[model samples]
Target: MAVLLHRLGLGAYRHRKLVLGIWLAVLAALVTCAGVFGGKLDDRFTVPGTESQRALDTLGRTLPEASGAGAQIVFTAPEGHHVTEARYTAAIAGAEAAAVKAPQVKAVMGPNVSGAVSADRSTAIVQVQYSVQRAEIRPSSLDVIERAAAAAEKNGLRTSVGGSAYGSNGVHIGPSEIIGVGVALLVLVVTFGSLLAAGMSLLPALLGVAVGLAGLLALTPAVSISSTAVTLALMLGLAVGIDYILFILSRHRRQLARGTDPQESIALATGTAGSAVVFAGSTVIIALAALSVIGIPFLTVMGLGAAGAVLVAVLAAITLLPALAGFAGTRLTPKSGGKQAQRSAAPDGSDGRATLGARWVRTVVAKPLLTVLAATGVLVALALPAADLRLALPDNGSAPVASAERKAYDTVSDEFGPGFNGPLLVLTETHDRPGAQAGAKAARELRDLKGIKAVLPPQPTHDSAQTVIQVMPETGPDSPRTARLVRDIRAAAPGIGEATGATVAVTGATAVNIDVSDRLSDSLLPFTAIVVGLSLILLTMVFRSLVIPLKAAVGFLLSVGASLGTVVALFQWGRLADILGLAHTGPVVSFLPVILIGVLFGLAMDYEVFLVSGMREEWVHTGAARASVTDGARHSVRVVTAAALIMFTVFAGFFPLDDALIKPIAFALAVGVAIDAFAVRLTLVPAVLALAGRHAWWLPAWLDRVLPDLDVEGTRLQKASRVVHREPERVS
Candidate 1:
């Protein structure tokens, strides 16, 4: 592996201009194609085979009106005025009439028709039903509704338009994202101590992200890409792109600072660090691509999209970074002074005055048990809040406070009830014409169920073979009570079916969200098992050690638990919500735990491989595990620290964005990176290694024989180089 990477790196370096040109051309073509052919991102969340989704699909065929996108234009009369009064009636009626004339609107139900008036009669809902799904509903259809609402506001009615049809599905890149890139650039400059090197590091990362994102968007014309997928891809692409470059470039500069030939150094660096990059990237890609096994379409897209981006990042790091380094030549070599020169002069890179990493590792090894217990204790304490963690998909109530959707959601909750925003559509499909009364009977049963706020009269289809019953829950869409109600209704399906001789299925935006959440929840444990099991196998193969991989997995879980606990506290419990700019709090996004496990597992392995490989490499040479832990950490800690910080800043930058979907995910990744890198990988890993001593690298002979030589530490390349150098000396 190292030899192949060495030749590839040398080839790229030799033909630097060609490599640069090819990459630029590819990026340009991808961007142009995306700009011309990319379709809009869809935010519609659907899970096939789930009861809610199956019901919705059935409705699409048997009763299109109920399956199509829905919207609500909530109108509030002036204080001391009722919407039913003659003065306010005209404006409400006018808005309803306009909504009826709107393009793609199949039906418009006013307060009088739908009985949607608030108890105070000061608020009313004009329900608009479109003849298309949310993704298919044109923006013009929503514009027409908004225009009517705006006109009605002139008559002293406060109006807001919102529903499944509203809200943006496009990924927004704001100043926060740019600021993240800027911070990453600063970290690179500081790490390399050269503006030229920093520019070289950031250039390839930017290009990789551009190419990856463009390619993703280009496929949108054929594939239904979600905004969350795009955001996740962007986040992973940029962070991994820079970190991968950092790994290879830092190795190259260190070799150059030690007076190695610049070209030879680039090749060796690529062979060594690039090998780790490939393995690390593969772990991430595998973890992400494993999302496919769950069989959820949107999640599959997200995982695959992010995996593709990481693949691009790995390619650019090995190919483009080395080519760019070829252009920079020996200038990337550190000056003959300061810590760089000092460390370069040392045979083990840990000789000179003790650096922070060296001192820290020595102290850790001095009292390994204490360090382990303390770090583990801190992580466990942080993870305590995870016990109370609840999972649910976001709704308009969780939207930005100033957004029209949020305003509408708030108004509906304040006036009518929170359930009005997320009423369940209970569909009763009768097998026989004699069972037409099943709809009425089902409605009665639903109303009698606990958590029932209001059950509208069932509306039968023209054929009377099916009926749509709107059942409102007492709580909001994101409420746990609402989720319980959904489950309760489904649990009663068998009873309802036997009594009415009809199949009962519940679906709506709210019910679908609940079903999606439940699906994700059920998949979490198995997905985690897969990721952890894969991590054990991959890390064992890479490190050729049993204890090391076990330690890495345990540390990864600690970081993940701590990160998730923090998210639950801040995002779910609303602790420090004001400081974080969170406008509302509810259950954590359903897919977050699964995403965190996959993403953080890969990232934790990244730190593990880079840091532990150094220790293993040192041990292989010196055969002293304790000294290897300290010395290896000394060599790798700086680069790993910078990489972790770069990742943290990049992920953290997205946290402050107004995107509810992206915010918690970004924050979780950021926190996970920080905790894993600083605490688990750097601190706990060294302690465990120290405690294990020589046993840390122990692998049964048969197990070792079974594992292929991955050469992640470039041991083969180093040995081959030594043999080549000795051959000339022997001849002399």
Candidate 2:
């Protein structure tokens, strides 16, 4: 496959130009389509049975007649006062009027009187419940709530609205995109000094984003994809797309500098580096596909988006790129081979000689233990911050945004209702026995809750014949108070449901958040296991060594831990809140870890592949472990560093994105790449391999028989039939 792809220079000049043009045209067309459909991508996902579907089912069965999408809106003033009759009445009237005209809203019943207003007149809660008359009450739900706030403002009240839909909107997308891009670009710019090369590095990245978005947008009609999903796509696309391209470009650059004929270099690159690119791309693709097992509609969408991007990126890197490189020739590296570049004096120093990339291998064999400890310490230090990780959703409206508007939210809430900006959702379902009055008691009990301001009169579902109860609490959505309400309700549900012979499932803004946290916990173990296991298998295949695979896997984990710990310490547990642009550590975005693992594992392995592949290749020529380690690192240092920089730059770009989830993931990798590429893979991995020597390739005879051999050393394929024969050319 690689051989065929690398043959672009076989054609004449006109054909080469034509082929390049065709690829550009194809890219342009794909990107144009992607732009048209990219806006709808999102990250807000739902656990398969426990998310939207579950809530919908319970609602459908419970109130066949009472068909309205239930939503919560909290109102606030200040904390220490009594509410006069006039003020309370006016607030209620305004809230009611606002709800009536809001899109998707069926009715507005309350400022239902209660403690929901808080002991002081500082806060009040309003229940705005809606019937699904048009689209599902998702993103648009908050728009209507905002419009209602405008209405209430006209009357004399301040408002802070939070709901599942609204909170998703507020997640910080900036950090992820900005950080990811920033980090990736930083690496790329450093790797390839010319802006053009860096720009080229981004080509696959841009395409991945375009295709991932368009495909995800297309899926919205049939699947429940959340707004948060796009952030995942954006992050993954940048990381993989850029890194994959880096691998090919480095190999191509090497061949060009060696003065190989353009056609020969193209083939050798494709047959060698390009093959690794294919396998790496495939690994990421398969890993992403495994997310389908998560039982999460949102995660599945994210998986599909990432997997699609990887597939496209792999194709572009191997096929389109080789053709372009073949067309560019020496121009791509006119000055690269010069000594000023601090380039490795590969033995064949000038174009075609044997290179001394074998030196680093010899050094490692001399001092194995020192090498291993240094690498281990570096990784361990990085993982330290992970232990302090605080998993909480940031209340920057929803995710993380340093927007003035987002900041203004805190001031408004503090002045009016301390808890007004964050709130929780409560879902109530009842059983239909001859007499199941559990639903009624749940409603009455809801009205009596201390922090709640009003409980709407229980309305029988116009669609499901079940009952719907709406309660407004003093805290708005996204607040700890709201989270407490959700927990309290759950604690209370068992007794209430038993008494009524009914089932009550709490699902609202706060409830969903709690659910997300719970679900994340449930998902993390499996996510870790799968990613670690798969990465180990891939590594084992690459090196044919059990101990080495285990070591790499452990190193990967340490990197993950270090990154998380740093983020948590800065953003949550450690309280470097100012540096992180965090007002305070609220809950970390619920999905960050799962998404982080998905991305970080692949990136860590990238360096792993670079270091190990080179070392393994060296081993083929000379079986000395030390020789292989030193030689491999010496050879791989430039290319891997360049690739890592590009990745880091791309990650950093997302720092300006509005979402917070990206920051940790991107920053972790940004720091992690440095550690993995420079310390672990370059220094530690090689040293360890040196110590292990032949054991790095040791496998039980029986196991070896069962496992297939992986040959990453495609060097022999570099010589074509022409290069192979020194005899006089045969007449055609």
Candidate 3:
């Protein structure tokens, strides 16, 4: 393929020129297409699900009955007595005036501000509703909410504003993208040392993001993505961009040091490193594609967006990066002897460590059975924690500075109830025509529910087919009481709505997450079966042996599990939580395992294919399984490590987001890359392959006879590509 590419020179560089043109077209299209994702649509609007989803939907209808935009706020103090007459009037008056001045706020109903103080009188609950439009998100509404929430917080009062649309959006997903990008870029700047290079390293990121966003636009007609799309795009983009550029740049630097003419060097650097980049990129794509098995739209879209971005970014790295490197000249060349450079400047990139991995590979090829047992043991150990897993989505609200909003939420919970700010949406679907009668029954049932503090009157929805009921919980949104209430609601809802003959499915962020988990688990077999099964097929075709593909699948699973276990031990298990500032180890983001497996599966395949292909090539030549495994490991280990390190550095560097959404996924990915690169890809795999011997290829003669022969390395294309060198252009 490399020779074919070289022979086909893209007019200027022949095949190299072709790669350049491909990059130009892909990047331009990706950049231009990303704009199509542009629209007035906001993806963050939470879809309906388990509890809160039902609550929000139901509350939207109930809001009008209470009139005004139907809002509430609470204030708390440690004192045991009610406010003095003067203090009460002043606080109430202050709230009233603030409401009046706030635009789009028709009025502040209830709380009366003066009364509604808690039983202890230390806490004051103000239930205020607006006679305004429902503003899930509007700049005007945002401004009003921020100002009103801030102004309403008084000197002696601890205030919190709940039931405002603007407040929810601002708290949950705000400034997170800024923080994620800022943190990721900061790491790259430190790693690269040159601001220009650091900036250059971001090309893949920009490209990846651009491509992912473009893909979102392209895919929007088919799938409704989350409002968190941009954030998700940024995370995947940063990792792919950094890793893609890291590998290519490392190769370029190595080439420059070897004194290859700048242009010819460009060909070699891109051909070798670019091939690795392309392969790794394909692996990422496969992994993200694995998320298709997850029934949740959130994970599905994220997987698609991330995988698509990675796909484009990989193409960009090998094609476009080399095109640019063709112009970078000496800029890519490393300075002599950084501290580590002085220690070892060998071409093998090992910092001169003993080659235990290759030696083990040799031993394993001699004893394939022993290697299988060993790899299986390592995998079982890593997978055990996964068996005990549970899932939850916590508020985990850590602001830039602990803001008034969070404190206010706590204060309000103390005064009114736990669900003051968080409401659960109850969707009651009946075979009978939807009308007030069904709603009345739902309302009564809601009010009777144990945690139910209030049931706003049911209202008709845009669909008009379902009635929405908003039920407030007895505890704060994130408290255990709320979660328990959510579960109880689900259990009781079906029976409660039975008289109305309404079918109820509870859904909110919390319930949606629970549903998502249930759905994800349900789909696990099909998803796993698809990825694992497809991988075996790809390997079967690539290696032309049934035994080899199975072995590859086994090794890949071990590496992925062990990698996951390492992450679980550290992040989820509380080993390095504090050190990483991710002290919240609440069962990991509900969707992380799926994302991790998808990614790790692909990467494991990458190592497996690269190693297995090399061994197969040698085996075909030597007709000795043990020698083939040993020699293949010896020759391919360096390239694999270099490829793996580039990916590892890029992923590990982006670990500081610390968001509930990103922490587990990022940590899991980092561990997968590190362990795959170091342990499984290096030491364990080779040892096992060495141990498997001829018996690893177990297909009956009839099956072997029928299979098509295919080989990835040491083929005619490889031999031809190595033979040609385009004339080197003088360094620009």
Highest TM-score scorer: 1
Against the unseen true structure, what C-alpha lDDT does each candidate score? 0.89, 0.61, 0.58
The number of clashing residue pairs in each candidate reads 0, 132, 48
Per-candidate TM-score against the hidden true structure:
0.98, 0.82, 0.75
lDDT of 1: 0.89
Query: What does candidate 2 score in Cα RMSD to the true structure?
Result: 5.1
User: What's the lDDT of the predicted structure labeled candidate 2?
Assistant: 0.61
> What's the TM for model 3?
0.75
Please provide, for model 1 over 470-516, each residue's C-alpha lDDT reduced to its tens digit, 9 standing for 90 to 100. 99889999999998998899899999888778889899788988988
Ranking by lDDT: 1, 2, 3
* lDDT score of residue 672 within candidate 2: 62
Deviating ranges (above 4 Å) for candidate 1: 434-436, 726-732
Overlapping backbone residue pairs in candidate 2 total 132
- Which stretches of candidate 2 lie above 4 Å from their native place? 1-44, 51-56, 60-95, 110-116, 132-162, 165-199, 204-208, 340-345, 348-367, 381-436, 442-459, 463-465, 468-498, 719-732
How would you encode candidate 2's per-residue C-alpha lDDT over 1-732 as one tens digit per residue?
Answer: 445544532442226567557656765765665456533434343454554336645664554213344444555543343334576457656666766676666555464542345455565556565555113655555566667766665555556554333433422445445555665666666666555666666765576556555565556555655555555566666667777777777666665665666676666666677777777777777767777776666567767777776787776676656656655666666366454132422452223432333354455457789867766776677567666544545544534444433534554355445444443334555445432255577777776666775565555554333455656667765455665776777777787777666666665444555566667768888889999999878877677778789888887777667667666666556365665565445555666777667666776776777667777777878887666666566667667767766666666655545455555555555666666665666566767776777888786778777776665545545545336643445533
